[model samples]
Target: MKAARIYLSVLCLSLGFLFGFSPAEKKSKATWIWQSEIIGQDKQQVLEFCEQNEINLIYLRIDMNKPSDYYRSFIREATAQGIEVHAVAGHPAWAFTSNQKRMMNIVGWVKKYNLESEPNERIRGIQLDIEPYLLPQWETERDRVIREWQANVEAFTEAVRDETGLMSSVALAFWLDDIPTPDNPDMPLSKWMIDQFDTICIMAYRDRLNGSNGILSLIEQEMQEADELGRRVLVAVNLKKDMNDHASFAEEGVVEMNRQLALLPEHLEQHPSYGGIAIHDYRNWKEAAADMPPVDRDHYKGTYIWRAETIRTEKDEILAFAKENDVNLLYVRIDMQQPLSMYQDFVREAKAAGIEVHAMGGHPIWALTESRGKILKLVNWVKAYNQEVSSGEQFHGVHLDIEPYVMPVWREKKEAVLRQWMGNIEAFVEATKHETNLEVSVDLAAWLDKTPTPGQPDKPFAHWMMEQMDHTTLMAFRDQAEGIIGLVENQMKYAQSIDKKLVVAVETKESHEGDFITFYEEGRGEMNRQLQLVTKALEGYSSFMGQAIHAYEYWKNGKE
Candidate 1:
């Protein structure tokens, strides 16, 4: 009976191959290792995590700076465990015509690395995670951005065409199915991508397995497209805690996540295109599985320093005043032309004294669409500065004080200005998203709570702004606690609903606007007293992050 069974199996396999049918394919269970540096730091821990989780494939982010030996060791060990490691690299900017070279650089590097490495240690494939939809231009210039993105994709495909056995893949958003292809409007962008790449990892980041908006439903179209094209598709889920409840399994815990994931093979095995599941990243998965404690949010007592030179000239006085006033956060203005050493010293001292310093810059014109380069310049400067500085000397966040309302164009083109402002904010967030340690914040006027968003009238513009940022400082500018609380009541409710942070701000500059707008005449004693009342009033609101004073110069010169 055993001999007959073996004979039958061999015969069936041979006949299937001859008849253009393939035997049962092994589905790949994959995950992404975004922090490539982790392999150098803790390779064993990463391997053990993958081994324990039964992961057979890893899309390891390539850090070109790291020596090839690190990747060789990791890939060799991974291959020994029946796992295949693919090189992963990308950035949103790479979708632009000017940045296509950056995308190709990854291809060039991976090709070189594979050539130098042993067969078992070689990278099995390459995956691009570039999502051009995150760009601000995607909203205002959708057609142009799409064309450029298509060109980039074509360039990428052509670049890798000759690299044999290097399976090409891309991590794409599921909604691309709704977008028509640039050249052929009849076909969906998702289908175009499916045809271009060997495998498509659809980021179907829903938490549940079933429902109209669940993981299975979201990837249905992509799966069908991939099936028709005879390509593989991996359903990717986010494990990051910051995503919305439906977008991640962060709150559901590993056991529940696994329970839902185990159902995938049963439902998807019928489709030959279903390649298996890919988690968003390694660090978040490990941390979530370990049930790590949440970081504490200390109340922010922040003040803005408009002059970059103040940090160098008044370092002693600033430190003394901050110590006396219990100030924990400072938004210091950045002078791009100044040497980074000046700020580094101040930041290091401030950090040692338990005060976090954020790089601050903005102008009224920055909100204009034409001024996007300026924003990118600042973002790039901060990123570069951070790279050059030590941890203790690095800026903790970025604060934008771009008051578009101050521009004359705001009065003439209110809607246009609002649209442009929104785009700039999107650009800022996209540029900063990868900086995991840097927080993004903006100064919002209190009256914005009453203004309706340009297209989203059901929600206030303030709510939309708060939703984009990690935290916002409401320029309530009221002298009394009740008045300040009243100005930000709607924002507080919205912030609490979204689980975002809000910081109430008071003015110290002697305002030509109104007496109630500033604490300049009220003296430091009265200002402190009023702030205490405001803190007490807002204590019950979970979104209340504490208070901020307007300007450092004015606050220091205010009445004693």
Candidate 2:
């Protein structure tokens, strides 16, 4: 009998492979479309999004009131693009025996729709998202509620089993494994649900992947149970903004979310029952993606204007030089002592010439605890200036070039200096938090990634700064692209993980520090050539914004 069973398994595997239905075939990428009317409103939008995201399966919410043509047309188009559409409907109240009819109505509708539609337009599956745990009765009469939920699920699955080609699935909470089955105390509710449904989508919502409470760990039991039963399980993650940071990737942006999702296959492919990943719903996921800042790779050619007097004395010459060098960003030094009209006129012209002007000021003393007021003074001055100027004349952002390491106190009290620097940054960010349009950015040394935070040894100071600011300009200050890339590699990875931006800056002024530290000796052609190489090399990193020259004076002089 054992030999016969082994032979049967081999035969089944052979047949599955021959028919292109092997259990180890390509994993399915699914998503939920909770708004049924979206199909009737703009079906092409949904189809195109699915195509771009490589979604092969969709649990489309069913609204029986709509005309059948909507589903037919959407499903037919999806089918042509190798996508499957499944009818989905359910509510917490549907778990009650009295609401059994409401549950049956969905099964009945899907059956009727599939019967009338052509092969390509047919509904491929039915998924019920009933969550009895959300009902108050489940808390008071837990046993009774469990019995009723099980009965409803049994009935629903039985009804679906009669259908010819329709599969049955359920969106189940990952914690259901802790609940014992009413009929078989040794079995888990999750296991029972897996047995009853053709597929189970474990709602294992989490932002990270490896912790005790992460997505992988939360769905381990469910995946094991499904594999033992030879069933399929799709891991689901929430993208809704309503969820906490740990529960959803809404705040992490699309690039980080994709970075996390891309690792699911490597960690899950070993399980025979691992189906794939499913995003919570379409609308929120689309909105979260849209919120991400568009990456204009290699687009920003920037240089600093360190002297405010230069903008007044050589306004036309500066604009002409900026245009000639394709400079889009100018970190113009803010001299609070100078007249505000000088900055207003210069910024207005810079805007007209298609250049973004950011107010810049910094000193090594600004990192001292006693000098925190100086940091806030700069922030307040920029804020006040922005409020006084027209939109075209306002500073686009505030950029700080503070190098606290240059202070003598940094050598005597390194940790104290780091703490004070962090405090100053916090003050700057707090001062400008209310300025909705004003971006807060700073210049950071590339090697800061090696310095650990005071208490959190695992997190680098560079990462913490990236988390607090809108973006950071890394002072790589290396003449060659290879050296510059190596210097900023760790910070680049951290920036990508947190969805922050980094602009790599190279020194052009002759440096007494080291020959490798500045491109001043390399001249304009070599600097431009090396920067182009850096851009091409770091093209894969979404965090890499572009390259920046140290200052307009030296760069322009070198060009001469």
Alpha carbon lDDT of each predicted model: 0.83, 0.83
Q: For model 1, how does the per-residue alpha-carbon lDDT over 375-435 read when each residue is reduced to its tens digit?
A: 7667656665665544545788888999889878888998899999999999998876654
Model 1: residues with Cα > 4 Å off, grouped in runs = 1-22, 292-560
* lDDT minimum window of 10 residues, candidate 2: 15-24
Collision pairs in model 1: none
**C-alpha positional error of residue 197 in candidate 1 after TM-score superposition, expressed in Å:** 0.2
| Candidate 2 per-residue lDDT over residues 295-355, each given as its tens digit | 3434677899998899999988998898788888999987766766578668866765667
Best by TM-score: 2
Clashes of each: 0, 0
- Residue 160, candidate 1: Cα error in Å is 1.4
Q: Cα deviation in Å at residue 528, candidate 2? A: 5.7
